[model samples]
Target: MAPRILLCGDVMGCLNQLFKRVSSVNKSAGPFDALFCVGQFFPESSDQLDEFMDYIEGRAQVPLPTYFIGDYGFGAPKVLLTASKEPANCGFKMDGLKVCENLYWLKGSGKFSLLGLSIAYLSGRQSSDVQQYGVYSQDDVDALRAVAEEPGIVDLFLTNEWPSGVTNRANASDVPAGLSDSMGSDSTVAELVGEIRPRYHISGTKGIYYAREPYSNIEAVHVTRFIGLASVGNKDKQKFIHAISPTPASTMSSTEIATKTTNTTLSPYTFVEKGSSPKDTTKRSSDSVSDSQYWRYDVSQKRQRHGAGDGDKLCFKFLSSGSCPRGQKCNFRHDFDAREQYIRGVCFDFLNKGKCERGPDCSFKHSLQHEGENYADRRPRSENSSSKRSKECWFCLSSPNVELHLITSIGENYYCALAKGPVVEDHVLLIPVEHLPNTLSPSAEHEVELSKFQNSLRMYYKSQGKQVIFFEWVSKRSSHANLQVVPIPSSKAALVEKIFSLAAEKLGFKFVAKKFDSDSDGRKFLRAQFDGNSSLFYVELPGSTILLHQIEDNEKFPSQFGREVVSGLLNIADKADWRNCKYSKVEETKMVEDFKSRFQEFDPNC
Candidate 1:
């Protein structure tokens, strides 16, 4: 059974009125698990400050596990700062402090789960200027957008500002006329609601109670219900409290999803079930099939150890359009990230810190890369391959712009970076410290060192029950070449082989398997084939099988074909473009730190 929750509008430091109202509600509706208050938790006038402090300081008692977000008023900063200092209040999600027992503050912006329900919040009064007390910061929006990216559900979204156009868009005549006009809906908050697509959206500061009908969202499975409340001590005696028990729609069953997604056209950016694949894959007679097609895998014959991966999957229609007919019966990933790794905008991390955290995982281009300086020259590198190459090569390990913190480990010849937009946590790039065009023709010593590095990685991932796949696209214009290393569940390794072959086949090129006596021999063979003009597609399979495809100068080959294969195999095909997986620098820093900790023991250079 779902827990009962009581939600209220601004309290305005009227503890006496609040107590009386709660007592009345308790008698009438009685028991509720939690009470959430929004907008102006502090007093408007000096007379009410002492009474509010009394309740916050614990001189008086808080009735329940009361959480609130009215971040401004007479004594807000003073109380919040004090609570921030308390050790118990510092939460993992960066959620705010506890003022007194059972009383808490939801500061800044973040989300957390309560009673099996997900809740996201943005705290601050609406303002145009960058005021400390009011107005949302870019960081807040960035963090919220990041939250919106995670896979799954956000049951409730709480904000201090009403979403702009809520009244007009909702046309909720039930709300008092022009009440939301003076305040209007906050554009940022409104946009957030549209992106988050939560089951329930609650806001306050308009000083009126409004419960709009569930509205449609094209990219989400469940409809959203918007509620606005008036001040607690309003002279009009408008409702200050509202109560409801909503079963978190995130827990819906598959039967519900099947029902809701009838005729649902999923978003182009999301997963397209293989059965519904838009790409036509007509098999030719095996006798006439190219050597590449020989690797074709039968996905039907494979058994997925886990049923379709994460069970918290969202409804297809909900993810595609933010609204589903299933209500709470559907299942799929409602979290924006779950929809696809490739998002249709700039990197969220770059927007926040001018740097992207995901490296290769991020599908979006780093806006900083477009700065006047040649991005290739700006990467970190060692001494004088040319002051020019190091300066122009963005991938050079010695470049000033290099996010050194992203380096996972140091090797004798080559080093690794967590891809700026990594497809997975351990996805890394193996690059030579000295600038070079491609891995096709490394000297024997470098080959041995690179081999050792690969061996070490192979052994480590094997212990973890995973397989690491290596691929590279050496551009003629590339300042340096780095081997793209990705890890996939061993179960998927067979699938990876078949997909790459299919991808190459679709592009009218065949990946010809070439066996070499050793790594050095393979490098020499590839170097002769590079011809200083033709582009190369290369892959290293799990059992030391190597496939190479050459796209001569005259051919039009999809440069993204390699990444497409990898992303498709991982079910994140949207992120093949790199522009799709943009994430925050803070998160990237975390990714680096995590990699460092995991790879430290195996690191040969460091």
Candidate 2:
């Protein structure tokens, strides 16, 4: 069985460094069985975060399981990476108290579970707040009490925050003297831990504060500190391990239940070569140092020791393969097959980006080639054919004067069209199928489908080396969901100029150059003139002091300001009415004039 090694700390970018150190250590200590990653820095988005998990898992590919315990979003379901099943997006609640077998996400807090306590409910607040200070209200206390009473439960109470104290409240008579005295004034988490001692406690917060010696009731206390390992081995031998040296070398501080030997020597792997032995005072003809100065591991002692004798022993053991007559193998031969294989597997699995020779038989399908093949070849023909179809009007099913093509097809009439413009490729317009007023809420099913479609389209376009600018406009006048797409320009200057020109011509907005004084209080707003009418839009461009605003008549314009704003920004706009245009024009015109006047007032010497 692999050694069950738990790495608990405030994990930052130390994962890569940790793997390297672990690899070096395994040369002697051997490979650990399981790795428990306990702390914050867990990625919220599965796509964004999987790289780190994959890295660790890949390195320790020798069936050494790993598990992560941390805070996740409420109602966010656990993602099962092993089977590629649809991830759970609901609250974090465990079906069973113990998460047994394989890589698992032991939900930290929230949700209804018999054994697991929702830290949010217990704290009478969100999980985030509870994690920061470990504070809990009265209502939260009640919820915790109810969960504690549940029978036949082996609960390893996990929270992103640590409790004020760690003690057993269930065994009232056996309660520690310090905890019993402080019970009344103790916080909710403290009281709960004092009453019912869970098997394990993992917190995301930092700091290490262990009670005095003979701390047996509590199993293991993991805290994030600059100090090294503090207390180890759960409740049994509660020894506080402090660094003999001043500063902490690792992020986590451990307090062991018992004191262990402190070896200050760096591992043999970390060594600097010297030309010759101090006694000899003679350098070899070759620049490289002789094997005498190199560090070597002592197999019998199971530790790294320096000098010639050590290297000779290691060389014989390794070179002779334990089969030489009279046991005359190389001195440094240490048969560490298991450790070498485990380390090799981990490096090959996670660190290396080589393709899998076993193909489907390989556990980690991490090859970029596989991803490309899956995305390109595995898509359904129907979806592919649909993508190739021309853009037609959602209402008339005929091509518009704009020579529009439908990019997003949400069934027959429900489609989003794009107008191909010379300046911007595939300038798009989104329109709904049925001619209903522009009030539409995408159904959950629609959202899922649309999101997936959008992602695939973006990926496909990106793979093909094309850039796209997506825009949407929904107007109440025509019960059509209008969406627009513009092709992105290759040159930065060209793209900006193109967008500015397009917005000025089509949307009656203009981009102007203006300067502001160093002490100017307000940003300069631009005046957008269109159709003998004008409005103000804020623009804040690089190397310019003016704020660019996309302004339009709120009431008098044919298009709603909201819709126009979305279109101008190349973002989705909410649908709104354009009925009371006449009433809105007076106020809108004044607003634009006022903004333009302010810009002129702030003009340099003015």
Candidate 3:
């Protein structure tokens, strides 16, 4: 047997009138297998709307699905017509077709299918003006027909506008002028039905009218004044009156038949079988109807494991739009769809940060939620290398003036360092304890820790008596790593140079020196220099350590070693290279002696 579906037009202010009418007409009317409301209107007050929707659903008693088709605000439909895997708050079942601006479909029983298409308002402009109506277009009609063409599946079309084709024009004024007269002329409701060939067509535009019989295999019905204060009555009688009246109609007969009949055949179960159950009947009834299933709120105990200290509460927030501070250029543009995609891709590249395709997978719900914090801690991890490690400086070990501060412990294999040069009072060198090839790409945890440490260093320098000058250098040959050096005032530069020179002498190594000044091209080597009175020198060290004396002369050295060293150092300083090392350590030492010999001859003051 085909399923029986009840299709109704916009409820507007006629809900009360219709409800009373239905109660009086069918005292024993069987529950509808499916109840579809083309567009339901509620009062401006959210409370009233909530109450009305709740009462309607509760009274229906069946899991009968209700849908809306129209535009609410926000220029888009606000109802969930289909299911989603990871649904957002906006996606939920039974939220009541809030502000729908599209077509909807619901299949009931075994035979009947209810299809609702919202007719876009005609503004008397071009036909394409329907786009502003926030409703379906001609293409949508074609799509509906394709779906409804299935055999044995009865289709019912309901809309606010009187579709193209239909002889009745009772309440033409009820419909907008552009739609009323022109719709029938261009494409009547009957023609549209012929196109889709639905089993039923219920429209509400023209004056009060009804078709006495069914047309073709499909039923074409019209109801003018179907909803009004006068229509509220008993099984046999109905009156035509305004919907705002509170009093019942006194003159209305109790036995007059309100439903007109024609050639269309009613399904055997139309007056018997009830509709299907709702997907979330229990949840919806127990919880607030406005409560979204996709949204959850809970408080849980949290404990820090490695990155942060123990028992520290990590508060995270997710903002949809306009959450972050927009400086001169607003980063939060509606057109950031591409940027969002890029962030998601980069986040997926690393697996540790919650496995999100977006930045900071943030899948888990944290107590504290905020926007722009997830991407706060982003850093690349270093890959392993096979180069030999350099020996520790003996002078640094023996000097009592040196201070070592452990900024952060980045995971099991790596640590960050803040080393104070012995002779240099406020001079500090920031280095990673990890023997990795590049610090540019640190582990996820390290990335976060690095940022935090940098912030702390900035604060520390500002608090001290001397200003801080920061610099970083890298080597080209060995997988280049950065060496961060911050020079502080109070004779720190001279002191650092003295310690470095003394360390080389004690270690039986020769000092390979290069002078960089503001005028020299080497000045470009500075990474981030502060404007304090103190001078700072930041040097990037090569991943592969070399003997200082071996770098002085161009002699027999490691394979392509001289070019590699010069290139690496120049790269770190962001400058052009002018000096090269010798091919051999012995010859390089000789060259260093000769260079120093010429310097001494030029300056007798020494």
> Could you estimate the TM-score for every candidate?
0.50, 0.25, 0.27
Highest TM-score against the true fold, candidate: 1
Q: lDDT values of the candidates?
A: 0.65, 0.32, 0.30
| lDDT (Cα, tens digit) per residue for candidate 2, span 75-178 | 12233333224244232243312222344444322223221222122211233343332233222343344344332122234443444322323211233334
Across 426-480, the per-residue lDDT of candidate 1 in tens digits comes to: 8888888877878766777887788777877787678778998888887554457
Write one digit per residue (lDDT tens) for candidate 3, span 208-264: 333323433322122122221111122334233221111111111212212334433
Question: Global CA lDDT of candidate 1, please?
Answer: 0.65
Off by over 4 Å in 3: 1-5, 23-26, 39-134, 148-153, 168-190, 217-606
Better of 1 and 2 by lDDT: 1
Positional deviation of residue 530's Cα in model 1 after best superposition, in angstroms? 13
Question: Candidate 2: minimum summed lDDT over ten consecutive residues — where?
Answer: 243-252
* Over 4 Å off, model 2: 1-7, 21-32, 43-63, 72-102, 109-147, 151-157, 165-186, 199-204, 207-606
lDDT at 290 for candidate 3? 19
Ranking by TM-score: 1, 3, 2
